[model samples]
Target chain A: MNSQLAAYATSNLWLIIIGMGIITFLIRLSMIVLLGNVKISDTVMRGLRYVPPAVLSAIIFPEMLQPAPHGVLDISLGNARLVAGLVAIATALISKNMFITIGIGIVTMWIWPFIIG
Target chain B: MEHSQSSPRREFWAGVKSEIPIAIGVFPFGLIFGSLGVLGGTPPLIVFAMSSIVFAGSAQFIGVAMINAVAPIFSIWTTTFFVNVRHVLYSATMGPKSQHLSLGWRVLLSYLLTDEAFVVTAWHYDNDNPEDLTHKHWFWLGAGLTLWVQWQISTAVGVVFGTQLPESWGLDFTLALTFIGMVFVTLKGKPMWGATLSAGAVAVAANGLPNKLGLMLAALTGIVVGMLLEGQGAQDE
Candidate 1:
């Protein structure tokens, strides 16, 4: 293990990692101490509320539908994620529940894959 | 009350319960992170360490993603930076609740910081009296710790046995579902929609960018687009 790590290491990898960690610690620490407890302006808070959904959806949607190096749509029907996502949204709107939204969407996405595959 | 017998334990479980909703959905992502970490040759200990010490889902993922044959210092820093910008928002929301806390407690909260806990704890504050904001720190610790522990255990499983698991068969969508739950709960108002749509468009359009620097561009664009739409929404209202 020692030999393998030495083979992988170059000059001062530790310095780089440590420096990066310090910077990360500072960014997070500053945010937590300074911004964590303050009341944010309404516009900022409203904008913040949207970040997770947007980021998550952007990550998920493209991963699901895109057809790889061939550049084709993955499904004409039975794209479990698309179907389940819509279902999840509908469930969320109707029931306003978290467990159901995830449970239904996951079960649906998991099954649709096997069914289609 | 039975709670009196084991107050700390009870408190700990209460913390877990508050986080359980997010956890059930989170376990799969944890498994994916673990498997990827193991496959990427991150020692089981380091994987565990990152999850415990860093304790940020996206950052851990980004770290493993960049554990290449020769990752430059700046590259690792850049990736972690983009991955955790969301924490800035998490911190802003947590601000008022910690004003009465000592600097030590503030530092601990920063270590235990997570977006879900921030949302849940902050919601509790926004709806309840700020004076009653005691013990939420405990809950945040419990939730983040459970996740940290689970991430390591799952990663160990993946590392020790990544070879055994068959084709992934697009199981990643379970993660997508978890995100759907979060997005649905929070996706209201015109600015949010505008920001979200623009970011999504950017993410897809910029898919060609190396190492997905597009994620950062998309997020920055999202912040601006959201603020702009908010300006518009305010006018209409």
Candidate 2:
């Protein structure tokens, strides 16, 4: 990775940023702009309802279980992120407050290492 | 109820006000992304440009990390595409509501469409009567602009000063926590729960897949499961 980073070129980075910006914008614009007037099927509409929870959970699970990106999954208490994520989940469920959940989650993540050590 | 009475200016400000708290939650992420980008060897100029250009938080983080790791450009683009495709869903949901707007309005609002902005704006759309949606797009514009400004400012701060902050502060975890809050709040009814859990499990199991294919697969699985369950529930009633 270090060697690759060393070999990385500024030109390549520019290419990436431009390419990513275009693709992301198009994705965001796909339905709202391109298909603005098209009639969506009921089935697709039903499926869209779940998109938020499903996509979000898909994101949340990996961040919590793996903690380290592309690393092995760790469900143990040793994984501070996992434990803290659980705390955040519980706080969200009970308090139904975004501020409280994030506050407690970050605090837990910060303090977990000392607690276990 | 008073949809027609409210001017576009009023709705726009209302949108901005509603998003302030959520924007506060999102502020840390912009900072983390900026600092991480620079620390990962990306130039400060490019890192800052990314906030304005790419705009999506998760995709930008992943893209910067991949660039730092010297991942192939194709893989980086592919990963970013999938990670952000969820915006397509958001756009689809918001499309009908904004269909009446001019092309320029649609274009601008689509650019501003984001998870945080979408959630708040969608909630507003859903709660109000469908007949009363004339100035709601202004609200979306206000909300989106607020987040957009906050993101740029935070990213600037992080790029300029974030490296001085300790990495051990684990500030990146705030993004995860924010998502957790979002997921739980949107989670109502059996189908939503089933979809969320299923998506989460699949994503974990499929984590080893190349180029983050697992995320897309897991999301699709969850959506299908949720739709099936909803269909079944309807039949049972």
Candidate 3:
């Protein structure tokens, strides 16, 4: 139940909420607000282009390689997520369609457990 | 389609139409956030408000998870901020296209900006003729608002039906799949492949790091690798 967490969330809810709102707002407004005056360097812009792939891979890799409860590393055929992720990657490469990639990925995950069992 | 370039109304609708597919893709993510928030014991009102006010999907998910873990408020703020630092890049990309806009329009557009909106608007700006950009902010507006409205609605729906989804459905994987699709579509060259693989390797290597700092390290490593590759090419030219 985490009474302390409940208390903290209840008491400071507005502050945390408003804090996140302002922080996110400012980040979104940063370069836009400074528009025309400050130019992002070409090198920096080049790096910026990698942000999506990097950030996305950072997010996705851990999900597949390290499944929760903190310590087991799963890169084997037994890891359903890893297998489904591979399937999704292939689907994405072949079709270049997000809908199909996600659809097949989900179906693979659903069916993987049954096959493994 | 051609008429949209002239009238703001038409331009706005075009943006909405362009965003429909993105919105559909985002809908489940929004629902997942709402359900995650509720399952974490956050108040429904707070979940609703945060979804509308904060409006960044991944950040909101992290914020709620942090709160549930009883993490310090400051750390929560910091994590969310870090998670959203990517928007600084998005804002920079959108700046040239939107700079001519009025203060009010800029402010509203900045507020509406999201990953989906950025993709749609970036495509429009890159593809459209330079002469047609005058009213293109309307297209940005349309796309941003479409995602905004859809996010709020989907979040509310998730909160209402929290935890009802069967565990076997593996809905969370869809988010990752969506990101994979994004990664695959955006991969145009060797530098991108290098960036993605290096990031994944670093993220896996740093899996045990606390507070998801592994993600930050991975992103930095990827950017650096990509930039180095780009620098090598630029020098040869």
Return the top candidate by TM-score.
2
Off by over 4 Å in 1: A1-23, A35-46, A65-80, A113-117, B1-15, B128-136, B186-195, B207-213, B220-237
Q: Model 2 over residues A1-117: C-alpha lDDT tens digits?
A: 444336467887888999999898889888887666588887887787787788778888898999864467888989999999999999999998888988899999999999999
- The residue ranges of model 3 lying beyond 4 angstroms of the native Cα positions read A1-11, A69-72, B1-11, B69-71, B127-132, B210-212, B231-237
lDDT of 1 at A111: 77
The regions of model 2 sitting more than 4 angstroms off are A1-15, B1-6, B69-75
Candidate 1 chain B minimal-lDDT segment of 10 residues: B1-10
TM-score of 1: 0.75
RMSD of 3: 3.3
Q: TM-scores for chain A, candidates in order?
A: 0.52, 0.82, 0.80
Docking class of 3: medium
DockQ in order: 0.41, 0.66, 0.63
- Real A-B contacts recovered, model 2: 0.83
In angstroms, give how far residue B35 of model 3 lies from its true place.
Answer: 2.3
lDDT by residue for model 2 (B25-76), tens: 7788899899999998888999999999888998999988988888989998
Q: Could you tell me how far off, in angstroms, the CA of residue A2 lies in candidate 3 after the best superposition?
A: 14
Q: Candidates 1 and 3: which is better by DockQ?
A: 3
- When 1 and 2 are scored with TM-score, the better candidate is 2
Report the lDDT tens digits of candidate 1 across residue range A14-109. 444454455556665675576644566776766665555556656655555553224344555555656777778777767677899888876776
Q: Please, what are the lDDT tens digits per residue for candidate 3 over residues A1-117?
A: 655434474658878988999999989888787876776676765676677788778878877777543547887888888899989888988988878887888889889988989
